[model samples]
Target: MRIIGRALAAMVLLVTAAVAGAVEEDGYELWMRYRPLDKAAQSALQPRATALVYSGTASPTAQAAISELQRGFGGMLGKVPAADTQLRNGAIVLATPASMPELAKGLEALGSEGYQLRSTVVQGKKLTVIAANSDKGLLYGAFALLRAVGTGAKLDALNTSSAPKLQLRLLNHWDNLDRTVERGYAGESIWDWWRLPDIRDRRYTDYARANASLGINGTVLNNVNSKPEILTAPWIAKAAAVADVLRPYGIKVYLSARWSTPLELKETKTADPLAPEVAEWWTRKADEIYRAIPDFGGFLVKANSEGQPGPQDYHRSHADGANMLARAVAPYKGIVMWRAFVYAHEKPVDRARQAYDEFKPLDGTFLPNVMVQVKNGAIDFQPREPFHPLFGAMPKTPLMMEFQITKEYLGFSTHMAYLGAMYEETLREDTQQKPGGFTVAQVLEDKDHGQRLTGMAGVANIGSERNWSGSHFDQANWYAYGRLAWDPQASARELAREWAAQTFTPDPRVTGPVVDMMMLSREAVVNYMTPIGLHHLMGTGHHHGPAPWVDSLGRPDWNPVYYHKADRQGVGFDRTATGSDALAQYAAPIARQYADPRTTPAKYLLWFHHLPWDYAMPSGRTLWAEMIAHYDQGVGEAKDLRARWEKLKPFIDARRHEDTANLLDVQVKEAQWWRDACIAYFQSVSGKALPQGVKAPARTLDYYKSLHFPYAPGRG
Candidate 1:
C-alpha cells in the first residue's frame, strides 16, 4: 500500500511541473503572442469561437482584420475558426450596416474609426459580433476582441466599444538615412533604407500590423532632423514602397522636411518662407511626393530647434514657416505638424519659459490644417515634468501632445522603467485655466473653437531588435503609449495590467506581481535618478548615467550643474517668481498654488522652489534626510523588482524569463549606480554627513565624477 501511494504522489508532482513549464519564446510577437490560455480559460473560450462569419466585401482592411482573428484564434484555441457564409451558433460576426443591417443600430454613434463588440443571438443562435461604421473600424474591433480573449475576459459577457479620441495617432521615428537612430536604444533603424524600394522586408508588414492593432494610423519614417535628399526622386520611391505596405492596414506615411531643402537642392537662392521661389519649390516637391504616395500624410517639421534651419534664419516667425508648408500640402488635404520645441540660438532667461513666450502670442495665427506639436514638458523629456504650459495657454490653436517613447532621459532601454505612469502623470495634470480647470488630457480634446485637428505623437522606440523595443519590459511603454494616445483618459495602472496579461500569461499569479512591478518601476527610477523634482542631471552628450558635476559645457544650459544648481547651500532648480519665474507660465491658480514651497507637491518641490538642506519636510525629516531616504528606498525597490520577476519564472517561457531576469540584474546595478553617484555628488556639494540609518555611498564623489562612457548607446 505504501509503494502504491508513493507512485501516485510522484505522478502528481510530474504533472504539476509540466503545468508550470511554459514553452520557450524570444518575445518577438509582443502582446500579440496569443499563446494558449490555461485549461479552464481555453475550455470556456473554445465553444464561443467555433466559426467566423462575415459576408461583407473583404477589403484590404477587412481582410487584414479577418486574418488577425484567424491568427489569434488559432494560437489561443488550438484551431483556426472556420469561415462560414451563413451565421451559426458560436460564430463571431463582423458587421456593418451595409453587411448586416439587423446588427448596426448602435454603430452610427461610433464614428468612422470606432467599433462595437457584443454577444448577441441571431435566429435563436447565440454568437459574438464586431460591428462598425467602416472597414477600418472593423479592423480596430478585431484587435480589441483578440485583446479581450488574450486577457481571459468572459466571452459570453463581451460588450464593449471604443473610438479614438484623438484624430492622428502617430509614431515619430527619429531614424537617419544611414540607419542610426537618434535616442533609440533599440538596435539599428527598422527601415532597411538601402534596400527599401525593391526588396521589401516582411518586417514592414508586421510593423504595420502591430501599429494598426493599437490604432496608430500614421508613421514618420525618418528623423525629425531632416535631410534634403529625402525629398529627391530616389527617396520618394522608397517611401512610396513602404507606404504601400502600410496603407492596407489604414496607416499613412509622413516625412520630416528639411526647411532648407530647396536651397540645398539649388532650386532656390534663399529658403525664406515668404519668398515666391521657396514656396514654388515646396509646392512642386509636394506635388511630386503625392504623385508617388497618393495617400501620404503631411510633413512633421522640427524647424528652428537645435540647429535645424527654418524661417527663423530669415528673421521670420514660426507661423511663416509652418504656413508655407501648410499651403504646399493643403491642395493634397495633408496637414502640417509644426514642432514647438524651439531654443538653442540665444540663451533665454529661463529655458522652461521659452516655448510659451514664443508661441502664446501667435496662438491664433496658424492655419486650420496646421497643429503646433508641443512636447509634454516645458523643458525636454525629463523623467517627470509638469504638463507643458502651451496646453492651457493656447486655447485658440489646435495643439498636439508629443511624448517621447524612447527612454532618452530615463535610464536607456535596459532599466525597468514603465513610462505609462509618467504619461499618466502628465496627462492628468490640472492646467488650472480660467473659468474651469482642465487636465492636460482635456486640453488636447478641446474643440470649443472651430478647431478640428487633435492628436498625440510618441517618439518611436521601435528598431531592428527582434523584441522591437530593446528590453522585454520596454515594449510595455510602446504598448501603453498607443493605448493612451487612443484614449487619454485611460488609467495607466489598468493599461499595465492588460499589457502584463497579454505579454506574459493571463494567470493571476503572473500578472498581479508583474503589474505591481511595472507600476513601481517608473517611480523607482525617479526616486534614484531625479527625486523630488530634480531634472536633467544626466551626463552631457549621451544623456546616460549620472554626471551632476558636469559644468564644463560651452552653453550654461547644456551642463547638468545649470539645472540642479547644487552648491554648499542647496540643491534643485528654482523656478519661483523670486528665481526664474518659470512658474508664472502656468495659470494664475497653479502659479499661486506652487508659489509657496510648503504648499507645493513634494513630487514637484524642487522644480519650482529651492530650499536649504536642513529645511523641514512634510515627512518630519530634514530635506537632506528625506533625499537620502528616497535614494535608499529606490535601491531597495529596484532589488524588489528583480525578486518579483524571479517568482514569475515558472509562469513564463525560459528565454523571455531569463532575458528579463538578466535585464533586471542590469537594472539593479544601474539603479544602485545612479543612487550612489548622485548621493555622493550631492553630499559633497552640501557638506553633509550620511543621515541616520542610511548607508553611505560606496564611492567618493571624485571616483564617480572621473568615470565616463564615451561610447554609450543612443547618442546622436
Candidate 2:
C-alpha cells in the first residue's frame, strides 16, 4: 500500500509539471501576440537585443515603452535584455533631447508625437537609438522598433520616422449604462458599471496597453443612444477611475452625452441650447467632469436623428446645439463631436440628401471647438457605399470621418469580412475638396480648420470575450483601424501583411496567402449582400439577414425596399435626374460621371440608376446575368476562403484554426442564403427568368420571407 501511494504521488507531480509547461495560446493577446520564435529567428534576434539603455528615471509613458520592449523581447526571443545604465554592445536606447542629447540630433524634425529609430556603429558595437522630442514619441518609437524586429526588418540599416496624419485618433464605444452594447456582436460590455471607482479591473490596464500599442489616443465611453444618468456624480467617479488607468498610456476618456440630460435629471425643465438654464447646467456639468478627470476628452453627441432630443427641438440649428456644448468644454480645451447622421422624423425627399442639406448651410456657423462627425457613406455602414457626399461638400466645417470597426451590417462577428479594404476605399476617394486637389484623406489633414480639431473615430467592436473581439479575424479590423488612423494613406494590404506576420508568423509563407484572402474579404461581402449599388437590404430592426422585400416599417427610410426599388420596369434606386437627383449633392464632375450608366463605375451602376433587366452591362451580359455572376462569385469566394484557411491549419494552432473553420462553414452557408434570397426577391419583382446556366434559388420567395429572427444578437 505504501509503495502504491508513493507511485501515485510521483504520477500527480508529473501531471502537474506537464500542465504548467504546456504551450497554449488563446487569442487574448491579439496582434500583440508575441509567442516565442523558432530556433533560427530567436537565434538571430537574441544577441541584438542584449541590453536596453533607457537613461534617467522613466516617466509613465517611457516606463510603458520600457515594459513593452521587455515584454516583446522576452516573448519573441526568450531574452529580456537587462536595463543597463550605460551603453554597451547592441544596446537599444530610448531617448529624448533632455535625456540623451548626443543621440537627439535631427530628431527635432520628428515633432512632438513623431519618433525616429536609427542604427549606428558606436566605437565597435552596434547602437540602435530610438530618439524623439517627448516621452510619448519615445513610447511610439519603442513600438515601431519592436514591430520592425518582430516582422524581420533588417536591424543593420534601420532608419525610420513617422508622425500621425490625424491629430486625434479615438475609439467610440456604444456601451450603455446597463452594460449592454448596441450593435455589439461580442459578449457583454467590458465596462462593468456595477463596479464603481472601488474595484478597478486589471483588464482596464490591458485595454489601455492594447490601444497605446496601436497609436490610438482617445476612447469615448458609453453609447451614442445614451442614458441621462451617466453624467451623474457617481458615474463621474467611475469614469475617473477608468481615466486613471488609461492616462498612463496617453489615452483620454470621452463620454457620449445624451442631449436631454438636463431634462431627464430635472436640473432644468427644457434642454434647449439657447436657454440660459440649460447652458449653465451643461457648463457646470463640464466643469465637474473636468475636476474629476483633468485630461477629460469632451462630449460626443447624437441628437435629433433617431428619437434623440436635440436643439432642433427648440427650433435651433445643429450648429447651435453643438456650439452650446462646445462652449462648455472649450474653456478646458475639450471639443465636441456632433454626429451628422440625421434626418427629420417624416420621410425625407431623400434620406441620403438630408445631412448634406442640413449641415452645408451652417458650416461656418459652428464654434471652433465643434466638429461634425460624418459616416464614411451617405447611408449606414453598408457592405459598400460610394464615399459620403458630405466628405468634400462641407469644407467650411471641420469634418471628421467616422468608420464603424464593428461589423454591424456586414454579418456581425460570424463572417470574416475584413474592413481594411473598406476604410482605404473611402479615404483614397478624390473628394475634390479643392480643384485638382485633396482626396478625402487630404481633406482630413487640412490645417486651415483653425481652432477646429481634426480627428477620426471608429465605433469600437470590443467586449468581455477572452479574445477581446468575438472572433479572431475581427481583431484585424481593430488593428487596421488604429494603424490607418495614424496614417490614413497607409496601404491596407501592407497592414494586412504586417498584421499577419506579427499575429501569426513573420514567415512570408504564412503572411502572403493571408494578405490575399483579407484583401478580397470585404468585396466578397459586398458581392453577396449588396452587389451593384444595392444597399440596406438586410432584416428590419435587428438587421440580422436578408429582407429586401421588407417595406412595412413606419418610416420609408427604415424599409429596405425604399433603398432598392425593384419592379417590373427596373431594379435599384435612381439618384439621376429623373429620380431623387441625389447625385446633385456631389461635385459637378462626380455628378456628371454618375449621370449616365455609360460613365458610372460598374460597381456602383445599380446604386445611382435603375435599369431594365435586359440592359446591357459592360461585360456584354444582361444586367440580370451580371448580377447572378457576382452573387455566384461571392458564394465561390466564401467556399474558397474556407478551403484556403483549411490548408493553413498546419501553421496555426488548433484553437484559433478550429474557431475560424467553424465560422467559415457558417459564412459559406450564409453567403449562399444571401445570394439565393436576394436573387429570389429580385426575380419576383423584375419578373425575369434565371439567366442561362444560372442556378435558381432552392426555395420560393415565401420560404425566405417566412424565415424571421424575432430575437437576434446585437442592438441591445
Measured with C-alpha atoms, the lDDT of residue 298 in candidate 2 is 97
Q: Write the per-residue lDDT of candidate 1 for residues 159-241, one digit (tens) a residue.
A: 89899988999999999998999999999999999998998999999999889988999999999999999999999999999
Instruction: Show where candidate 2 strays beyond 4 Å.
Output: 1-23, 123-125, 448-452
- Can you write out model 2's per-residue Cα lDDT over 502-585, one digit (the tens) per residue? 888888778998889899888898889999888999999899889999999888999999998888988888998999998998
lDDT of each: 0.90, 0.89
Q: Per-residue error at 436 for model 1, in Å? A: 3.8
**Which one is best on lDDT?**
1
Native-referenced Cα lDDT, model 2 = 0.89
Clash count per candidate = 0, 0
TM-scores of the candidates in the order shown: 0.96, 0.97
- Model 1 segments beyond 4 Å from truth? 1-22
Model 1's number of clashes is 0
What number of backbone clashes does candidate 2 have, counting pairs of residues 3 or more apart or in separate chains? 0
